[model samples]
Target chain A: MPSVKENTIVTTAAAVELRGLRKSYGEVVALANLDLSIEPGELIALLGPSGCGKTTALRTLAGFETTDEGKVLVDGDDITRLPANKRDMGMVFQAYSLFPNMTVLDNVSFGLRIRKANSAERTRRATELLELVGLPEHAARFPHQLSGGQQQRIALARALAIQPRVLLLDEPLSALDALVRVQLRDEIRRVQTELGITTLFVTHDQSEALSIADRVGVMYQGKLEQLAAPAELYSRPATAFVAEFVGTMNRLPGLMNGGTVTVAGRSLPVDGTAPASGSEVDVLVRPEAITLRPAEDGGGLIIATTFLGSVTRVRARLADGIEVSADLPSHQASALTAGTHVTLELDEQPVLVAAPLPR
Target chain B: MAQPVTARLGRGAAWAAFAAYFLVPMGASIYFTLFDRDNHFSATPYTGLFQASGFVPALQMSVEMGVLTVVVLLALLLPAMVTIQLSMPRLRPIVETLCTMPLVIPPIAFVAGIIALQTRLSDADPYGPLSQLVNNQLMQTGLPLLLVFSYVVLALPFAYRALDAGLRLLPLRTLVDAARGLGASWPTVLLRVIMPNLRTAILNAAILTLALVLGEFTLATLLGFTPFPVWIVTSGGDHAQQSTAASIVSLLVTWGGLLILSVFGDRRRTA
Candidate 1:
């Protein structure tokens, strides 16, 4: 029932590598000796905070920023010296980047028009991209007439219409409504996968990176903290920054020994590289790994409970005056009240531990 | 919320004041142009403009200079503005200070500086070919072409303001990057994307340049050339009635031209 062109790939797979990129603005370093490689047809999301250099890395790859010392290689071609227009890449920008004067159809066909594609061919490819993004009916409309989500969809179509070797997305969904953002992010992933294009998506939103990217690269202070699969990055962070930034981590005071950290009378195996033996450390635990139970002699008291659809997060204060939050099934947490005393237990998952910080 | 009756009356009075200030002199001029000394209707003031010597040529020269000045303004300011916004944003404050500098300088002082430069260049022989090129090629072009370059400076504040406001409305760097990533060369991006998107700004700036050039008199008169305004004053010393008609016609034509340009920019952009 599908068309003949649906199964064929339009964009060729490209291996993108950024090696030793070093950029600075006066005294501030935006990127410092940064290196990243994306395999053919893979989606890599660079995740970080506002000044973390993730967007700078993406812009460097797109040839927008001239690195003080680095090489940008696409399919083994050193393109660090190449101009952006000659790089033959596609970039979906963060803002409403559609040309205001051009119609949606014209915007999509812009690349084709620049390449001197004839009318019929340009229209065919543009129409194909529009249909791919599911907006064939809005081609005649201007960008201002479409909703923010729709305009971004057209932007995506325009990026892909040229069959670019690698696609660069610079926080393309940060301005949209929450519901629309999720929807558009899913569509972007779907279309990128369907075309088998190598993509680098940059964002400060950890959830967005975790949900769509094949591998997430966490950046901090102009340096790469860690790069790994979403589950691995979440479950076994290489650095304490990555561990704390990706998701909520409850740091409980615990003692570290070779392969384990003991917290609340229980010793759990360390998830990542274990710290020195017999050292004072702060053990990291996810909210979901904590189990709760009612006990007459319990040293913990439930302070608050927040419902999050199928699950609930319960905040409790320990005998040591440390607060810990546990994610429990909403059905079971409904029975617990603020005045109740509860005992906490850890699921057998390996825990990450960091050095104790000065109070 | 509805305004109170007293507040409404106050607003109405303010509007009446502005309307009276704008329309009263215009009404008097219209009455003067349409009547003769005998208190009967006549079109001589309007018709006599055609009979004036060098009227058409002076008007033609002003239009030409206006168009050329606008062309130069766009060619000079747009690239500088885009480059500042996209590449070297740190230079923005400095560039803005430089561009809006004409506003602080009086026209008389600016024209005096130009006259000094012209006098110096006219007698230059030690600089060799450069001086020869300036003295022979440029100085010989008469007033129409020489005035364009000076008018561009005087018109910079207005034109730059228009273009800067328009560029502010756009995510200029993003649009340029998007275009370049799509395989558009620099000229293609400028002509196709940035320029088309800037139609309203271009039109607005062009109109401002035209208005300035068509109404400017000091520089043209001091330079010993008779552009439209200079010709209007020189010829008006003898023909009092037609001078009033000429001033009114210039105002009306500038308004009409600006309206047409606004409509053209808006309609074409939306269409």
Candidate 2:
């Protein structure tokens, strides 16, 4: 284990600092000038689809991959040229990569053994770590003897055994089933908080990122679209891609006339600057942000209805044959079947508006 | 349960055939050595058994040379196999071909060439550097180098295959990565993980080398080296009783070595 000064502030410490990080493989650019700064004692989730450079960033920080350009500073020191072993960073692989030949205790104490810790102290620490991961009785079993979830937990404990400054997780829960994933996610969060270790979690699941991260960075096309608190990101997306990727957004192709937008043959009030008149633009509205009401005299009809326990989603077709999806509270939802006459009400202001692309 | 008569008759015939295959040779050899009417245990024909002659010296020389051959073969082959596998994965076929080359070359043909060269050089200038080195050190060391070279040639196939199988079974990448991630240097990783994981391979190859060393006679005879098999052959033709005794002794030694190898050679590689 590394020794830290007693007078240093632990929480506000910046453990990982990446500046102009760039990596590419032949003709494909994996990471194009990625810059990210992570603070100590904070769990930041890197959420993106496959090939979005999330894993590349984590590997760079762990010193597993070399940066084509720029530097990686850890604990206020540049580690651009250091090897992975000397980086003192704990990493949990996507596959529960436990050493299959060793028992759980030995796997957990591998780092300590390499550091030449005493036998008694190493055993005691390893046992405590196993107990911390809720596997106190499984210390004697080999990795193959355990289930997938148990193996992941053991991998986690083995990573934490070294007490590293930063914990890097590469989709650690992706291999487990849904129920075990949720269970292990909570346990990982709890352990992270208990240990107060700076961790970078990479995942493709939006809900998992939104639920577990203190602040989530939404990545797309090798660049971060937005990095903010989860609530802020969901409530106010920074870009059109962020809005569509982070949550469900019904983008309505519309025309900007003066300060108001016309979409689906209906005029909606805009809260932001409207594009030039007659310019093609897209009007973004979330499902829950729009409201539906029974309007028999109106020109729209409900084409489909999906009941989701708490809220009912209604897909209504306008007079111009464009479909608009809106969510209604279950209690306030009308008993409107498919192909029933209805009307949408613009019940909320501050609607997100974006410019449309050229045809 | 009731048995069929035809099956019983077939089984009895199979047993008779098996008995004739293995037991007849032992019976004939024992009969020839102990109760042959031609020699009748006469002291005159048993002149080779006298310790004052060349028999004891040859026996001692063969035992010493066989042990040295086994040791040198193992020492040279283990590290060579490991280094070739670790450093040059692409050259594996070439290395394997070289390791197995001795199997295809006839021992007599190989030793014939060696003897031809040695005689040519010895006649040209016995006091030259090459002749002096060979005669002074290699030949005069009781043919130790020749015996060791013979053992290596005979044992290469077994050693290479065993170590190659071990290398395949070992989780080399995981072990190397684990050691490196724990701040261990390359030498430490090789010593701690690589060597220990190859224990079974080394033991199996050692036992195989020992067997080949003890049983090899063609190469030893061609090279004029005193290996156990050559000694046994010389002793056998001299006196039937002493030759049977030496055969039993060699058989016991081979069996003991195999027993030790089997006992300790069962190992599972760990990452």
Docking class of 2: acceptable
Give a tens-digit lDDT track for model 1, residues B93-183.
8988888998899878988998887776776565766765675554443444568888999898899899999999887888898999898
Report the C-alpha lDDT of model 1 over A284-354, residue by residue, as the tens digit. 88899898787778999999999999999999998888899999999999877796899999888788888
> What is the TM-score of each predicted model, taking all chains together?
0.94, 0.71
lDDT minimum window of 10 residues, candidate 1 chain B: B135-144
Residue pairs of candidate 1 with colliding backbone atoms: none
Reference interface contacts recovered per candidate: 0.92, 0.25
DockQ of candidate 1 is 0.83
lDDT of 2 by residue, B1-271 (tens): 8689999999999999999998798776656555557757543323434452455666666667666766777667666666666566778899899999988989888888777766765563746686656645556545566556656777889888887888887766555555565566666666666766677876777777767776778877777765556776776665667677566556766788777667655534322
* Model 2 alpha-carbon drift over 4 Å, by segment: A1-14, A256-261, A265-285, A290-308, A312-328, A331-359, B1-179, B190-271
TM-score of model 1 (CA atoms) = 0.94
- What Cα-based lDDT does every candidate model obtain? 0.88, 0.76
Report the CAPRI category for model 1: high
